[model samples]
Target: MEALNEELERAGAWVFGAGLEPASSATVIRASGSVSMTDGPYAETKEQMGGFWIIDVPDLDTALDWAGKAGAACEQPVELRPMQRA
Candidate 1:
């Protein structure tokens, strides 16, 4: 993963990246007329996001290339989505 980050940095595609704590450690907050708090993820599911990376690449092809590298390095499937343009 360090190698992947270094490669991304060299290509100027690295923006930000991080790993998250386990879902059991999550806190959920809700407000609908009032406020409420809950423990764990917002939705009960078999899968959860373990971590993510934000890359600034020129096109989807470039993004896919990075995603492929990331998935191989982590030995896990990676999900890629574009950030909304400002």
Candidate 2:
């Protein structure tokens, strides 16, 4: 983990962001015609997002490459999503 963080820092790709709380600590909020709040995670599933890393890479392939590295380093799946552009 330390090595990965150092590598990302050296590559100028790490975008520091807040780490999410555990699923048990999450509060799900929803709104349409009216606002409603729910305790716990948005869904009752074993799979939950613990945290995220925002890495600025050249393209999707590059992002995937980084994701692969992350997966190997952490022994966990790394999901890649493109940023929405205006």
Candidate 3:
């Protein structure tokens, strides 16, 4: 995360958001014959989403570029997905 943030810094971009989430803070809602809200994880899991980042870029290549940098920067996993034009 530190390294990735550094790359963004050199590029004049910054890590928008990054943090950890607890499994307890999450709730799962489902619509069935009756709606239900469950405690704890909607499903059993080990490690949940720890953190995330949102970076503004011009296009796909730019997004991928950032993702690659981030992946290399952190020992943990990193993912990148293009958002629909909004």
Each prediction's TM-score versus the true structure: 0.92, 0.85, 0.65
In model 2, the runs with Cα more than 4 Å from the true position are 44-46
Q: Which residue pairs show backbone clashes in model 3?
A: none
lDDT of 1 at 39: 83
Give a tens-digit lDDT track for model 3, residues 1-86. 77677777777666477786777888888899999998777576665776777787777898888877776666567777765778
Worst 10 residues of 1 by lDDT: 39-48
Give the Å error, residue 34, model 1.
Answer: 1.5
The Cα local distance difference test for each model comes to 0.92, 0.80, 0.74
Pitting candidate 1 against candidate 3, the one with the higher TM-score is 1
In model 2, what are the clashing residue pairs, if there are any?
none
- lDDT of model 2 at position 36: 95
lDDT of 1: 0.92
lDDT of 2 by residue, 9-76 (tens): 89998887335777899888889899999898867577887667888888988888888988887787
Candidate 1's C-alpha runs over 4 A off are: none
